[model samples]
Target: MSLSAHGAEGAITNALTIDVEDYFQVSAFAPYIARSEWDQRECRVEHNVQRILELLRQHQTQATFFTLGWIAERYPALVRAIVADGHELASHGYGHERASDLSEQAFADDIGRAKKLLEDLSGKAVLGYRAPSFSIGTGNLWAFDCLAAAGYRYSSSIYPIKHDHYGMPDAPRFAHQVREGLIEVPVTTLRMLDRNLPASGGGYFRLLPYGVSRWMFKRVNAADRQAAVFYFHPWEIDTGQPRIEGLDRKSRFRHYVNIDRNYAKLQRLLGDFSWGRMDQIFLPDQQAGAAVV
Candidate 1:
């Protein structure tokens, strides 16, 4: 049930990732959020995530939830709910801060805080992390050493594309080893001739119709040698959230463009490919003998 099929047989085993954060809580939304006005709006994010939980449960699928330490501290019940449902839990840093905003020590402290909080609440080892907004690229690759030192096994933080906000234009597409014994599971992209297209499923998928997402993903499989990782937030399907203010037209368009159609499109994806956790996708080839856990 990992994201690609098991990364054997020349393709990926299925793996699903849930980045649990509110719409108002994303770093992109931070600029407009006055700290004096923020708190756990449990009504919005928690309630909406329960919808995601319902979908996964309905499909009997288990996923890796990259959660905010801020969310966990305020919503311990929700954290417990995810763990109790047998889903894997991972970190999304503390307070939704980006890796670039912190010094090396600050980032390490944030990771530690999140890890300790998640472990204490869920009673499980938090082995994975994802920097907010794909914030670990060329200049900030040093964050990897801190993550590995903080006892993380893998990170899903590199976008490997040139986005206005973040990306590592020259990073590898598939999973590779980092300097700190950390595995880099970069977002999926389809390479055509010399171009790396966004096959790592995300807002691009939500904005487009199911046919487009399906077509591009199929092309990724047909061309690329492994499973293309797909990620979407629970709020992407929650069309009823309050319309935000202070965003430019581009942010407004990207965030809310195809809300009505996304759920149906997601239903299509749920049926299209097998979905599981990171632990499952990166499962070693037993036939090849265990390299390391």
Candidate 2:
């Protein structure tokens, strides 16, 4: 679990991550889509992930896939394909529940289940975990203790912004050791106008113009000189996925804004900056532990 910067002499290698979950599983849609209804919904994750893999292949980039245990159990081959294509297979917990909502023991069980499930499927030690909707914060700092006890070496679960739903604005903007064995790599952000702006991707990446996103990331690299952690979801690229009804206006806008144009923007992003897996950038000494299975 030793850490060292892995960027080249003049270029910083940013961490590119994908949260592998279906569109129906978004935290905002929880009120509309019940967990029991998850099985009845048409699964698009397999196809969407295939497209993502092809996109990464075309760019010749490797990334970290924070895959859900639910998705992995159902789409085991998809997980294998990600590993076979040389990406890091990390856990996104088992059920997509927010860490802040779970008791420490419940959170521990969720992470443990996901780590074992992902490792059993991919034959790699699952070293990373991202909470659903960036749900880990000051209120649930014990989640880090759970992660460490569950054998996770790092977490990308904290979003350092002032958001209505999830963010710890005062947290470190870059990776830092939060516990004895675990590192907390908050998603990339830009400090501006005495406030932290969301630059790392997700809804913000889609909401802002491509130029704005690009400028923010470039600033982080040139000004901060730190490896920026950018994340997106498989569902973000699936414009054809089934739409959920009864969503409030804000939820609808946040989930579907500019999704049709996201894939192309992602291509531009891949070409614009250097990208690599999370562990390779942040935990340079640890191998991804890829295995054939």
Candidate 2 is scored at a TM of: 0.97
Compose the digit string of candidate 1's lDDT tens values, residues 52-97: 8888888878788999998899899999898888787889998778
User: For model 2, how does the per-residue alpha-carbon lDDT over 119-184 read when each residue is reduced to its tens digit?
Assistant: 998888889999999999988899998899988889999999999999999998999999997899
For candidate 1, give the lDDT: 0.78
Candidate maximizing TM-score: 2
Candidate-wise lDDT, in order = 0.78, 0.91
Highest-scoring model, lDDT:
2
